[model samples]
Target: MADVVIIGGGITGLLSAHYLAAEGAVVTLVERGECFREASWAGGGILAPMHPWRYADSINELVFESESLYPALCEQLQEKTGIDCELQVSGMLQLALAPEDEILARQWCERRSRVCEVLDQAQLQNLNILSTQFSHALLMPETQQIRNPRLGKALLAALQTNPAVTLHTQTEVNVIETEPLRVVTDHGVVSAGKVLVCAGAWTSRLIAEYSSLQIKPVKGEMLLLKAEPGLLPYMLMCHGRYMIPRADGHILVGSTQQDSGFDKTLNVETAQLLQQHAQDVVPALEGAPVVRHWSGLRPATNDELPFVGSLPDRPDIYVCGGHFRNGLAMGPASALRIARQIVAS
Candidate 1:
């Protein structure tokens, strides 16, 4: 038996395996689909919590701490794997389309100095194409973005090269058998000293027979637009929607938050709505061709906080899912905390 068995090969599970193996623990990770192809790969890859002040103090603290860890993590990943995860520190611009929205944004900035900076109309105009749509904006200087798909592939490569880690892809874990500490999957049974479930949207269903944790699926759809450089330099947010720019001159416009329960299919109406929002924020994008459109399910909780630490009734079992929209942003730190908890116990 291995020291740890991580069920679900998304960012959380992969990171958990990385950390556990680094600590000299024998780790095995199983995934139902290709690693990181679900929500982790489908996300916009924004590293900042959207409006940090809107969340509880604990959530804000967790996000801020996680944001702080990205620099070192990115540097280490690139150095070790020789893969450029495209960690961009260009920052994020949250625009205000109306006076009331501007006032609310200003107040939000006042509470956190390091996370957000309230920008005037002139300052907002200087960022990029967003100047025409909004009179004011909040610039998150410390915020950053990563190429999630590339990061996922890099992680898989890293795990494969590590002798202490074993990765099983296209393997579905049906149920977790706790007495012997074994995970019953479609292929075979994996026995370990402990089990950590990081199964993203399928987390609740994975643990339902054993635990009663309430994890819901939140559907999000995004559109990718190919544009030239100088079209959009940074990320933009307005009214819960956002446009994220990539280094390759493509801007990702997203996303519609619906409670559609595990439906990953994209809808034409939502896609068009996102495209319209992108064009409204930057008219130049109206001509940008729609290169891709996709959807994923975000694991959300009743109170919008991720379930970290141990399972209530089972000591050998643990959970680290239900991150909602901040999975990519919070993956590293969440995995670190979960691993530490398991190791210490």
Candidate 2:
């Protein structure tokens, strides 16, 4: 029997397997499709706290700790897999279109005590390429971003190369056969000492067979645009939307949240809205050709916090999904914490 069985080969599952294998545990990861080909690969990779002030103290602490762990995680993954995750420390700028929003942004900066600068109209003009519609802006210097595609690919490669770990792809887990923590897949059944489900948006459906936890799928649509260097140097946020620039001449503009369950279709309205918002935030991107448009579902809980740790009734069964929009940003630390809990038990 394997030391641990992780269902869902997204960022959380892959990272959990990496940590477990490194600790000399026999780990096996089962996935329904190709690893990291789902929402993990589709994310924009912004490592910000998603409005740091709005989150609970526990969530903020977790996010801040996770942010600090990224550098080492990136370095180790690059050394092991020879893939660049493209971790960038460029600050994030949250522009305010209304007076209330500007005041809220300023208050957040003050409370956090992070290095933030409030920009006036003249200072906003300095970012000449971006739209001049914002009345004020708050710059957060500690936030960071990463290339999620590269990170996902690297994680898949690293997990495949780990001798202590086994990966089964194209294998969908139909039902979890608990007693001794065995999972019933379409191909066969595999038993492990413990089971951790990180199935992202599919968690609720899978868990419903046994547990009554209510996990919902939140749909998000995003756009990818190719642009030249120095087009937009930093990440831009406004009107509950974001535009992230990459070093490789690609800019990611996103995203719209909807309660459309499990629907991954890219709607025309969402694409148009994203384009309009991107253009409104950065006028230079008005003519930028959109290379790709896609949508993914984020597993969300009622309280917006992920369901980590062991399940109440089933101590041997654990969960790490329901991250919503902050999955990529919080992946590393969450995996580490869960792995430690498994190891200690």
Candidate 3:
């Protein structure tokens, strides 16, 4: 039996294993499907929440905590794994179509002491962004992002190099028994001194006997358009939709949040609509051929605040799921908290 058994191989699970192993805990992670192919892979990888003020303070706390820890963590992952996750410090450009959120953005930054510079329409002209008189803009220069796919690969590589950690792929966990901390899977039963459920949208179902937690999947669709590097310098956002430009000439435009259960089916109509939205915001992408269009299911909670920390009455069992769309941004901090709990116990 391992010191810790983690159920879920997404960002949260991988990072948790990385942290726990670093703390000298013998850890094993079980994934029902390919790790990182879920919400973590489908995310934009932005460091900060999209319009953070709209979220609860608990959500903001996790996001902010992770923001301070990502740079060092990412640097360590790259050095150890030999994979460039493309952690870009490129600033985020937020264009507001209405005055309400514009004012709220100001308040949000000021209250939190976050660095945000409000750019007037005249200043917006410098970005060459097509906008109307009602549009407002801000530049978050301190914001950071990563190519999530590369990050996932780097994480797996890092874990592979660690002898203290074990990773099991394509292992579906059907039931979890807390009496002796055992997990039943198609392969076999694996018992551990402690069990941590980080299964995201599947968390509720996976740990149904443990908690009455309600976690549902919110489907989001995205498009990857191939453009020349430097075509769009910053991560551009307007009207709640944004385009992320990668150094490798991949521009990401996403996404729509709808409660679509666990369905990950790609829709042509949604792709066309997102493509049009992207082009409408920046005419430069008017005819850019879409390199890829995909969708993923986000594990969401009732209030959008992720469930972190241990389960009640089950000190040896832990949970850190329901992160929704902010999994990539929140992974490191969430891992830190969970590791601290395990190490302390």
Candidate 4:
């Protein structure tokens, strides 16, 4: 029996295992599929909350804390695991395509007290401005991003080499029992003092009767395009659509949030629409070749906030899932918080 049994392999579960083992807990992680291959690897990796003032208080809290911690955390991961997560501080440009949206964005910035520069049409033209001109733009200079796949690879390698942590891939948890404080699996039973249900999109179905969290799978479709490095220099977001440029000249444009239950297949029509969004933002990307198209299920809750506390009836069983699109943005701090909660409990 390990000290902790975590049920999921996405960023949430893997990071939970990382923090727990770092704190000297015997941890075991079970994954239904490959580790770090879900929404964690599929995200844009922006450390800041998308539309900060529009998000719920829970996301805002984790977003701010994670933004402060990501720099040091990425540095340590690279030094220890020899994997460069490409944590870049390139900042973000939020577009207000409509007059009303620009007004709302300015008001939201004021309400949140976030550092932002309200740019006029001339100022917006000076930047790598979108093709179709809008009212103005909101410049958030402190916004940061990471190469999500690299970060996922780094975390997985760190766990694989850690002697204190045990990993099980292609493993499924059959049922969970409270009194015995153990999870029954097709592979075997895992007994632990604490069991965290960070199973991403599978949380609600897995623990529906055990907990009150109604987690649903929201499918997000994204596409990658090969462009010149300077084609789209910074991240551009307008009307919930975004394009992020990588150091190697590849830009990932995404995504469409569909209530598609557990389906991970990529739709070409949806991918084409995302590609069009990239082209609309940066006309140079119109020539960029299509590289890859993928989709990942974001675990969404009723309130769009993650259930991070222990269960009401079962103090030993905790939950840290349903982060929706902010999973990558809030992952690190969420893990640390869950670790402390478990240790203190």
- Model number with the top lDDT: 3
Alpha-carbon shift of residue 342 in model 2 (angstroms): 0.6
lDDT of 4: 0.84
lDDT: worst 10-residue window of model 1: 96-105
Task: Mark the regions of model 2 whose C-alpha exceeds 4 Å error after superposition.
Answer: 97-101
Instruction: State every prediction's TM-score relative to the real structure.
Output: 0.95, 0.96, 0.96, 0.95
Residue 132 Cα positional deviation in candidate 2, in Å, after optimal superposition: 2.6
lDDT of each: 0.84, 0.85, 0.86, 0.84
Output the TM-score of candidate 3: 0.96
Specify the poorest-scoring 10-residue window by lDDT in model 2: 96-105
lDDT of 3: 0.86
Q: What residue pairs are clashing in model 1?
A: none
Clash totals in order: 0, 0, 0, 0
Higher-scoring candidate on TM-score, 1 or 3: 3
The segments of candidate 4 whose C-alpha lies over 4 angstroms from its true place after superposition are 97-104, 107-113
Q: Which ten residues in a row have the lowest lDDT in candidate 4?
A: 127-136
Write model 2 residue lDDT over 15-111, tens digit each, in one string: 8998888777899999999999888988899986657666776676667778898999899989999999999988888776466755666676677
Q: Write the per-residue lDDT of candidate 4 for residues 199-279, one digit (tens) a residue.
A: 888887778767777999999888989977876656888878988888998888888999979988888789878887777
RMSD of 4: 1.7
Clashes of 3: 0
Ranking by TM-score: 3, 2, 4, 1
